[model samples]
Target: MEQPAATYPVHGPSLRKRRMALGLTVQEAADKAGISRSYLQRLETGIRERMGPKRYTRLRTALNATNDQISPPPEIPTEER
Candidate 1:
């Protein structure tokens, strides 16, 4: 039998950015994601790194994030702008 590919943790900053881009406050996002506001805040601030599959799914759906959108973009140097 073939094995499935592995998945990784969602990036915190990307989650925050996505949530903000969608115009959701932490409370709203948490409510939509079925998690606590404090938990969502922890995820955004990097106090938490990983979420279980259920919570992850809820959060991803709430944020409208595809797999490719979960990771944060590289920080560009000021001089590069």
Candidate 2:
């Protein structure tokens, strides 16, 4: 039997950058955005890829970030199995 390929979510560096730029701690940002600190951390670290529109909007508003900063990075193409 063949094994399935693994996939990773797009990395989001802008999230971390914006948060730091605003001088907000992970917990503070998460609280302001009504999300968990781990969730915020995963988003920043690319562990979690996609954020729903509501969550994205909340994070954007909390970070005072522009669309560019809140948006996910361009996905890299992966080779077919």
Candidate 3:
């Protein structure tokens, strides 16, 4: 059988959306969050999984996101899927 594409563990508030709302560019936001633009880009695009919790927290703060606004509980993957 053909396996399905590997989706991320969860869908969360997009960093890109919030950054746009705040009128910030990826470079600007990444600078504020003390990360590289490419890293932020990856996070926004879901190309990276499991950004470090501490760094994620910093990013949430830099983006001025409330816990409810940003945190998406991870989806548990089932073996038989």
Candidate 4:
């Protein structure tokens, strides 16, 4: 049986907190992450969900967040197929 892929929900507040703690404005963080400011704002405000690893890595690096801090909520286990 094959298990389903893991999917974690984006933790918006934490992202915002980390960015602020680093004294980065939204534009600065977005530029560092190589994403648009609008998209970063959406992520910070919880308008977006389910960030893939590539984007997550960029954001994590930009915010200088540790693995634990950047980790999203764990995906619920599903029945194996």
lDDT of candidates 1 onward, in order = 0.83, 0.80, 0.72, 0.81
Give the per-residue lDDT of model 3 (tens digit) for 31-62. Answer: 99898999888777777744665677778789
Candidate 2 local lDDT, 1-81, one digit each (tens): 975335323246888888899999999999999999999999888888777767777888999877766666667999999
Tens digits of per-residue lDDT, candidate 1, 1-81, equal 975334347678888899999999999999999999999998889888677777888889999899668755556878755
Selected candidate, larger lDDT, 1 vs 3: 1
Candidate number achieving the greatest TM-score relative to the actual structure: 1
Instruction: Point out the worst 10-residue segment of candidate 4 by lDDT.
Output: 2-11
**lDDT assessment of candidate 3:** 0.72
Q: For each candidate, what TM-score against the reference? A: 0.76, 0.73, 0.68, 0.73
lDDT (C-alpha) at residue 12 in model 3:
31
Model 4, position 75: C-alpha lDDT score:
80
Candidate 1 weakest lDDT stretch, 10 residues: 2-11
RMSD of 1: 4.8
Give the per-residue lDDT of model 4 (tens digit) for 1-81: 985345445678888888898999999999999989998888878888667677777888889887678556678999998
Over the full model, what C-alpha lDDT does candidate 4 score relative to the true structure? 0.81
In order of lDDT, best first, we have 1, 4, 2, 3
Clashes (backbone N, CA, C under 3 Å), per candidate, total 0, 0, 0, 0
